[model samples]
Target chain A: MKKTCPNPAFLGFLIATAILVAIPGLSYVKQRAPETIIPGPGVTRRGSLSDYLPALKGTSADTPVFYLEGKEPGGTVLLVGGAHPNEPAGFIAPLIVVERGVAQKGRVIVVPYANGSAISHTEPLEGSPASFSLKNKAGETRVFRVGSRLSNPLDQWPDPALYVNEKGQVLSGSEMRNLNRAFPGKADGSITEQIAYAIMEIIRREKADISIDFHEASPEYTTVNAIVAHEKSLELAAEVAMYLEFDDIPITLEQSPKNLNGLSHREWGDYSDTLPFLFEAANPFMGRLRGKTDETLIIEGKDPYYLAAAKAKRLNVPYDEKGLPLSYRVARHITAFRYVLDTYNTYYEEKAIIVTDLPEYEEMAYRNLGDFLN
Target chain B: MKKRVFLLAFTLVFAILVIANGPAVPKLAEPVMITTAGQSAGAAMMKVLFTKSNIKDFVFEKLVTADEIEGYETLVIVAGASSKGLGAAGIDFDGETQRVTALIEAAKKQGMKVVVAQIEGAARRGTSSDQLFSLFVPMSDWVIIVRDADSDGFFTNLCEEHGIPLTIVEKSIEVSAQLNAVFE
Candidate 1:
């Protein structure tokens, strides 16, 4: 009786539970591991965020920075993407540059995933996809992780119910994990703050003339298709807007307010000599009017709910049956980035920064973005 | 060859006349002052405008006074009156108008070219900003305004009626380049 075999139904239940558990557990492990990024020919060297903040050594907060330097020394421009990793285009734009761009006369530093901790998990309660696939011209499909806006709770736990930022500005407790709100960050602070501190340190250490943070906003948000520039950067940002407009890409420039502390646009300019600019493109999945929270909506940016909202004149951006594609949004950012650098070179004759092999705006809009990747 | 020489001569003379006859622009080489009616946003913008362009050469004071106006050959009266800014400046609405009116008179008396810039957008339009707009737009030789601030075509129509050269901007951030042109 003591050596009786296990019941058939019980064994079956156990087997089913094991399969179900293993399926997700394996996926979780894969997501937690760093995503593969093949550096392009232009990349001379690479470093981790921990180089700026040694405390981040061997921690999940560490991220890679791809360096593309020209033979002749000139100015440096810092490009940050994936500050809120859920916005897929923000990450993809910098990723494309790191994989395809080569500097012609200046140094280019790119942080494709600024918040490494955020990339380890999907946003909670959003029913977001774990990953999305991009097909290249060679018929190979590359799957990229869709990440969260906040630092994963596993890495940064126990919110303070409220957070006072570096500027002594109050924010929601959960916003402590938002990298965008932790700029000019304190080293002896939260993980998010430590990451922010590392970024500021990088900007100052590299002597970045222009520091840019790329982002995505909901279509209904008024600031979509807009660039928020610190006062010192408004001239360069306006020039970027002018060129984008001439290329049939309509973008507005908003002067970042002095009272709005802790934002990348505001804090970076104040804390460092780097002129700060934050660019935003429209993402339906990031908006409240989204029809579904899925990879299709994130990458394709086609949501019928946003379309209806546009018809009602509720959306700040133009929305139609032809949804704002991921390719278009990423192209806008890359093109804007190119023009900003162009204008910066024109204005600062002594610190002229020239870059080549950037993703062309038209090709990125009409062709496949993945084709540009290495 | 005779005709070509004559045309070339005409071009040279035209350029000479334009430069000799005071630039057809208001006070390029002389000092200009960006004076706010009562708004700090306008003042913040003026500071940025000065830094970004040659406007710094002309921008003598961000917030000018009657005494300060005498030296500035061009006076740009940025028309936006924020109560908070006024309170910070230690002026009531009535006091703000009196000081602005006196400053404008002093500028005009000093033969300074006047431009009123309603560049703070619509939020500043209907508020006490309108009182400042009323006094400055008609008196100034030129008017600069953000497009959204003139939703009812008030600034445009006013500029038209007053025969003031109007500069309409799609964004306030672009106002700096225009200010450079205005000073030129």
Candidate 2:
């Protein structure tokens, strides 16, 4: 008499909740597996970042490294893209470098996904697209993943109330997982720190003379379309700006603040002999003024809200009906990269860094970005 | 004793003559620093395109004065208007135009070789930037314009009509080797 069945209505509610929850959680788990990255003709050798720092081995943070070495030996350059995974141009720039770059007389080492764990997820509640598609030269569409700004808490969880980095610079708790802020890292530290440490190891092991961190910024940010360089890298950064400007790429130069701690440009300059430079391309999609966050905003970069802001004279960089597409941004980074090496070669005659076979800025902008991809 | 005294006197006189006339200094092609007369972004572009050349490319984004141009072997004026740039410099459009025009006039007065460049494409060929272009193109001894502008033969015809040596580059950077040739 005391054995009574539970309410069917309550069971029905429980089943509905479980079904709703399972669909999204399962999708998230499926997306956690890393996406495929195809190496191009330029990639002569490939390895994981863990090769430099074995601590990253068998971990979610280990990422791929594509190296392009020329027939003639010369200086080596390290290009780090996707430092912040939300920035698509930053990721695409290094991808293009690996896929299309021809090492003229020097070596170009590219890491398109510097933060392996970060790429597996998107920013929560942003309504961001998981990936965007581009038609390659053969007219076959290729997909690239878009991810969050920080390492997935699944990899590095429980952010401290305050994140005092290796250099004692206090940042918001979540910055503990920001690759840009964790650079020049400790080997046995958290996953983000280990990834950063691996990158520094790449610079040390490869003897990279120049290291560039690609980034993007809100159109309203004053530093948009600018190069933030270490004091030692001022000359190269300035030259790169002028070079891009000549191509109508609209580059400006900004010296990295000496006091800023735990930044890629600052830490790389302090910890190694490498000249470090960071670039911020203007992306209206990342701006607070953006409207309708979607794949089109990420790839095409056309936003009506930004156009209004431009008309109101509110943006730092130039914005018009044409919009700041991913092609334009990638072209800017490539042009700067070419000229920085050119100027570096001029100053250091023995260390002539020449990389060729990459698509030019005008062609990428006018023709199609997919034309150069494998 | 008399021969030695005469030899000493001859040597002393030769030394005096050499000291008074100064030593024969070898001439070298020195570097020339480049700066914008009105803080135009185009000047920065010109400097980049002029790299690896004997042009002695230096970019000074401030208003380049006649005093600074006195010793330059060649002066390159990148004629494009950036009102935003001028505004940042705390100067109005009229003032910047006058300052640029005066700097070029002064370079000419000093007999410094002048090459006016407007390699920026159609986007830079707007109203105010056009006025800046016109002010110096005719006055310059040589002209360098990007082929983008010469599609309709506007700049080439202008150069021909003004008897200025005109060069049309497929891309702006192509003009670097040719510019180095000019310096040579």
Candidate 3:
């Protein structure tokens, strides 16, 4: 009997074929980073966070900051999004502003993704999709990342049994990775804290008169669809709230607690001269009661269980079958930003910040968000 | 022949042992039981009992307490009332009023506000009418009552006689809308 030898050529071909077959599946595993927003006509310059803090120069936390400056030179306002990556409305609102807003009187600096590493992963235990897409007016689909609430564990691993934040807050170990909790961060800390420190450095260096941190919360949460303002920002927040109410958006103004340390509103105010404000839009997908945590649930913001809960008077936000769509939440944030800008102008005439080309809440709601996107 | 016989006997013993252990494993414990309450018109507005941190830990035994009263500055509460069992235990209606007073005092100290909720309809569990008045009415800072066309104006007139601010919410959805208006 003759022994047959295995063909090396055939084995190599088999290996190549296996890799080719996995290419498509592996592409899905790779995160879909959002398309870069081409700054509009109002954009004066673009800079990186590393410019302020060289320590974050080559790290994933270093994000591009868009600057829109007016010739008149008035107050400077800083708008940050993606403090919590799961809240897309927080990021998209500023992204839209960067691509569309035209500054007329003062300056507006927008950081679309404050925690870039957080956008690299999805929240563990929540089976959420990594990305979702929206169709622009020209029929081109624009994809955006649906990221985790905290920094990727790969970058910062083995959480302490309990994380005592810089503010001395004892929270779950995982919260140490949360950028929102790492505000006024230490320069020589973890990656998340370093990113936060970079942001604080930027605010202080810029002498930002006002800062707004955007976020979203579950509809079942009591603080949803509200503005949480630091004590110093109360008068401005009240004016914005009143204006929003008149516009029929119905936003509640909440005073930030003094004792809640490390929060963007609390720390930014305590550490810097900038008046800090945080906005929360209701997101049903983030709710504990939601079912089938997927991109549809995220973008469409619909859930049968939430509707039932709403009917039973258990939810904080109004839940109809129509659901709280992405466009509505984005519109809410955009409208609140406009109101805050207007309020800022009224309070400080010498340093008035005025911007145009931003859509009103109803206009955005009717035209849909894609109409505004570049 | 002896070696072949030994091998056959070992195979037979292995097969018997495998068959004795079944594939399906038995459960260790019974499943937990959960109870869900049916939806009612009054469900829209929860009659949350507001107590100071010390008393709240004891009084609002089963109800969820708002983290801070400022969370619900516009919330309405009915005052001078206790739960049925609580009222019958000689927790005086006057004592309930003092508790509400203490809560208001503490709220002011914390730079918060309080709203008194009124009860619209009486809940009847048994022959004791005090359960209806003691449990739901006086404890809320604000009162909301349900009045049908057949009530002969009894509940409405009584609420008005006490100078309580009352609103008639006929349907469950209406109650929700009204509560949203107050809280939002």
* Candidate 1 per-residue C-alpha lDDT over A1-374 given as tens digits, one digit per residue, 9 for 90 to 100: 57989999999999999999999999889888877788888888899999999999888889999899988788998999989999988999988888888887778999999999999999988888888878877878878898999998888998889999999989999999999999889899999999999999999999999898999998877567877788688767756764565466756556676666678998999999999989999889888767667777766788888888988867767678888888999999999998888778877867877887877888888467678776
| Better by TM-score, candidate 3 or 1 | 1
Chain A fold similarity by TM-score, each prediction: 0.96, 0.95, 0.93
Query: DockQ for all models, in order?
Result: 0.10, 0.07, 0.02
Q: Is the docking of candidate 2 incorrect, acceptable, medium or high quality?
A: incorrect
lDDT of 2 by residue, A232-344 (tens): 77656656664565556766565565557788988999999999999899998788889899888877889999999988967777899989998988888887787788779
Cα deviation in Å at residue A365, candidate 3? 1.8
Badly placed stretches (over 4 Å) of model 2 are A1-11, B1-184
**Superposed model 3: Cα runs more than 4 Å off:** A1-29, A32-34, B1-161, B164-184
Among these predictions, the greatest TM-score belongs to: 1
What's the TM-score of every candidate structure?
0.78, 0.69, 0.69
Ranking by DockQ: 1, 2, 3
lDDT of each: 0.78, 0.76, 0.66
Docking class of 3: incorrect
As a whole number from 0 to 100, the lDDT of residue A374 in candidate 2 is 80
Lowest summed lDDT over 10 consecutive residues: which window, candidate 3 chain B?
B32-41
Reference interface contacts recovered per candidate: 0.00, 0.07, 0.00
How many clashing residue pairs, candidate 2?
1
